[model samples]
Target: MSENEEGTPERTDVRKEEEDSPRDRTRLSDICADVKISEVMSEETTVVRESESIEDIIELMTRTPYHSFPVLNENDELLGVIGQDNILELLFFERSHRHHHTHLMAIKALSEDASTLMVHHPVTISPDSTLCDAADLMIKHHIDRLYVIREKKLAGVVSRADIIKKIHGLRRQ
Candidate 1:
C-alpha cells in the first residue's frame, strides 16, 4: 500500500523478493539438507577384489547395471572405485583392436588387475552423513557416486541417481 496524502506509511511484502529469487530454486542444499544418506543408499553393492584380473573385472562391470564398483583388498579393505572415468581407457584400448588409433595404449597387452585400474584412495562418505553433505562431496569432486564407509569397509553406495530418486519419492509422497 502506498502512502496516503495524510502521510500514512506504506506496506509491502518482505518475503516477495526472496521467494522470487532464482538462487532459491537452484541450490541442491535446500532439497537435500534434511535427508540422511543412509536412507537412500544402495546396500546391494557390487564390490570387486583388487587382485582380480582386468578381464574378470570388466566382465563383472558389464554384467551389472551399476556404472562403478568398489574395489576391495583381500582383507576386504576399501581400496577404491572402478568408475566410468576409469573405464574410458579400457574402451579406447578395445577400440584399438578393431581399428588403428592415433595412439597405442600399452594397457592393452598388460594382464593388469583391479589394483591397476581402480581409482586409489577414492573419496568416501560416512554412513550418517546428510544427503546435502553427499551432494556437496559429489559436486566438489565431480563424481557421480560415493561409497558410504563404516568401520573402514564399504557399507553401501550412493549415486546421483539415488539422490534424484529419493527426491522424486519425497515429492510424490
Candidate 2:
C-alpha cells in the first residue's frame, strides 16, 4: 500500500528512532581534535582592579596559588597583568638596597598604589580561539595565562594548568 501524504510509516519510524537515540558517543580523537580554548578554559577566574593596592594584590595571591592576574580598569577593561614574580622582584630590590629601612618604607608606600608598577598592555585572546593558538601565544610571550575575551568583555581564563589538565585527561584513555 502507498504511504500517507504526511510521511511514510517507515520514514516516521526511522525519525522517531533517531530522535530517541542519544547523541553519538565521541571518540577520544574527537575530544582532542582541534580543541578550542573555550572548551578547556576556567570560567571562574580571579581578577584585580587597576586601582587595587599591591599589598591587597599580594594578599589575594597568598590566598590562592594563582601565578598571575589580569588588571582591569574601573570600567572593567583589561589594562595589564601583574605576576608574583614582579612582586618578588620589588621585595628583593627593597632588601638589597644599602638604605634598607628607607627602601622598605618606600616599598610599603609604593605597594599602596597600583599604577606605579603594574605591567601595562597584557596579551589577550578571544574565547573562540583554539587551544593551540592560546598555547602558541603563551609560549611566544612566556606567559602562564591568557585572558579570554568575548565581545570585548572578560569571559574566562586559559592557563598552562588548564592545558596540562587536558593533556592529562587525554593520556588516561
Which model scores highest in TM-score? 1
Reference-based lDDT, each prediction: 0.75, 0.73
Superposition error at 73 for model 1 (Å): 1.7
Top candidate (lDDT): 1
lDDT for each residue of candidate 2 in 18-77, tens digit (9 for 90 to 100):
477533435534554578878889988788887788779989999998888877777777
Query: Pairing residues by index, what is the TM-score of model 1?
Result: 0.69
Model 2 lowest lDDT segment of ten: 22-31
Model 2, runs deviating above 4 Å? 1-33, 95-111, 170-173
Residue 34 lDDT in candidate 2: 74
lDDT for model 2, please: 0.73
State how far residue 19 of model 1 sits from its true place (Å). Answer: 14
